[model samples]
Target: MGQQGRSRTNGQGGPGAVDGFFEYARERQLIKLRRDAGESPPFTGDPVLRAYRFCNVFREDDRTTAWFRQNVRDVLRESPTEVTLATITFRWFNRIEVGEQILDILLEDGWNAKRIRSRLRNVQPLVTGAYMVKTPPGMSKLEGIIWCMKHINRRSLPQMPMTSLELAHQWLTQYPYLGDFMAYEVITDLRHTFQLQDATDIMTWANPGPGAARGCEWITGHKYNRHSKTDRVAMMNVMRELLRLANSDEAFLWPEDWPRWEMREVEHTLCEYDKYMRAVNGQSLKRRFDASHQGEERT
Candidate 1:
């Protein structure tokens, strides 16, 4: 979406919303910190955070992601192809039930797309709203997904490249129906896996997803072009700069133990913060996870 494409929803959508990034970020982490420490219902004093949902500042800390790591990551560590296969397939749906079903098949039956299709066909909510899944004509979303999963080679595969998000994206987009945004999602998750531990790029470079892009627009006060490589780099620079400031500035109040933000953390936080700003303004952002709710949030 371009500058004209995204409008501030209400009175709160002015300079204040844009500038509240750090404070909002700090409060969010503190909210989770207190909640995890077993503090009561109100994890945050901020009304928007208390009532609505936002993902953790870090993706791995999100429940669905933790499930992925526990179930799929360790299981597939020895098999590079399996990591790629499972990560890509699980992320396509981004649903714990679906991921659980996939894990069962991958570890037991070994890539049974037919069973996956059958099980998901009658399921009320087949996939999470996290990623867009647009199937080709005449194919259900499951059918398109099964077709892609089948094409995943179980044999030795190409060398896993730990280069940049741009390159990983190029390779991942080769999967059927995995477009720019969705492929970017896969790439982010992969960075957390044992397979991509050497992935140096993700630490400093991240593909600015839509929410993050819009968030960057607010921060930079510049119209963002989601597809423009130049625009992505500009956003990357801004996020890195924020990470630097958040860690260095004592005036920037945050949890004492709040780990310094990486580029991906910065990216993830910006995206959620955008939804937060909009939600507080009375516009509905995609509701996912919260202190009381268990869910896989959206784009």
Candidate 2:
């Protein structure tokens, strides 16, 4: 059956039908609210006032729900399709009503079916909870990207100015289980979104010793000693470039609309990093043991 027919038969129907149901439900709720207040519905065309009414009807006394409904529209407004897809993927999928609103707005704003399809690919993978309960095959790539982005945390690395290349190399070196693909994705995001440059500068800055003072201060908080003039100058140059890239208006931030997903991805990334570090330390111990045994045999 065609989508419209299938949707109708399955009770999913058209957007208009769904919208009508919500409108009716909202009207009934407002009627009850007005009756309780001993007055008719207050008339107001102000966008904020209308938003407040919608929040009151749909969210009731739930602070989180109200906050989401209030700010979600702003988050979606004028945001790129990729960003919007990411946001939706991060938010719990049970909130289909919100998703519909976003889709409707996008459609109204002249977004084509192809654009929607592209977005769906980027958004689908990041979905968790009930939304991801029984995902179908042939889902779009946008969905997968969203899925990964939602789950991947690029910030578990020490709050230092390590470039993406450095972070990936360190992660792979320390954790044998962290494959090239995973490291690449994490590192790329750190570079493009988090403004990390590359590995060499990161390693130089992170050098830990009594004489090590030249590095990104945001992470190391140590100024380059003047005595090491060359090192100090190089560190300063790298730091300046890092700051320039990160401080730009185009730099990415976890959107306020995606608090849940942002937290989940970050937490997961940190856990993985910690696990990798422990595994590396275990390998080091094994190597030491092997070396000692070989030395004894030689003696």
Candidate 3:
């Protein structure tokens, strides 16, 4: 037997071995799925892989600050460790909240529209530095991008193009979350609507959700998943902004190739999707939705 096989047989690998094996199996399955789907593999580079590893590490030991220090802080070149540490420690805001705070700060600092555009690059680092230590599993790199864009849109900062609601709808479709409502709202409030062609492109790029939709349908006279034409347009705009943000070079530290590679690989695994749907349908609606959405996106 190979070392891995022997280790598993001897029970010497323990949970770590089992976990690694499962991960390997999952990747293999993903590759097969991509091949079957006739698609290229998704990208997996420094930032994307590192972010995934960091999230895994965080999940394994939520209490440990070492993960942040080792994974994120150590990656910085010229920044002082103390400064990085302080930045991580002092941050009290969630990803979106922090973006809002930064927008306020920039405005307060007399950053003009041009300066805001230039300084937009600084938002990622600032938010990353702040939330690196206590990163949540539900908050993805894409979410961070959306949050940053929302901040810019919310502030109506100069030079920032007006994003529409239809775009937001598309982005939220890919990565649904409770916080996305605010983003949707902002897009709806803005003018200069996107063309339907642009909206579809944004939808394709934004990768919106297949999960249960949530928002102001509660007290406000609106219904979830029952968006009006105006609402749909607004959502599309928001989604477009999210796509733009996500596709930006600074969106992630990982080599841009990683997600594309993984996405491509995952697409071929229709059997896996079928299996997941059959096995976990009753127990996990979210999983089912995710699998279905991924499958659709792959095609």
Task: Output the number of the TM-score-best candidate.
Answer: 1
Q: Give all candidates' CA lDDT scores.
A: 0.69, 0.32, 0.30
TM-scores for the candidates: 0.84, 0.19, 0.21
Please tell me which model should have the higher lDDT, number 2 or number 3: 2
Which one wins by lDDT: 1 or 2? Answer: 1
Give the count of colliding residue pairs in each prediction. 0, 14, 47
Which of the numbered candidates is closest to the native, going by highest lDDT? 1
| Residue-level lDDT tens digits of model 2 in 1-299 | 12342233222223342222223223424433454566633422222222222212222223333333344433443433332333323243324443553455333432333554545544443332221322224644344333433343334334433443545445532433233333433343333222343345432322121111211221233444534757556544543443333233443322223222221122222222222222322322122222111111100
Which portions of model 2 show Cα errors greater than 4 Å? 1-27, 35-66, 93-132, 135-299
Of candidates 3 and 2, the better by TM-score? 3
Candidate 1 matches the true fold with a TM-score of 0.84
Say which prediction, candidate 1 or candidate 2, comes out ahead on TM-score.
1
RMSD of each: 4.9, 27.5, 20.3
Candidate 1: regions farther than 4 A off: 1-19, 108-110, 249-256, 286-291, 294-299
- The Cα error of candidate 1 at residue 79, in Å, is 2.6
lDDT per residue (tens digit) for residues 1-299 in model 3? 12353233222223443232223324433433454587754422112221221111111122222333233323331332222222222232223333343444322332233433454544454433312332235664444433433333222222223243344444423422324433332222121122121233323322122221121111122333424556554434433433343345774522355342221111112223222222222333222222212322110
Q: What's the lDDT for candidate 1?
A: 0.69
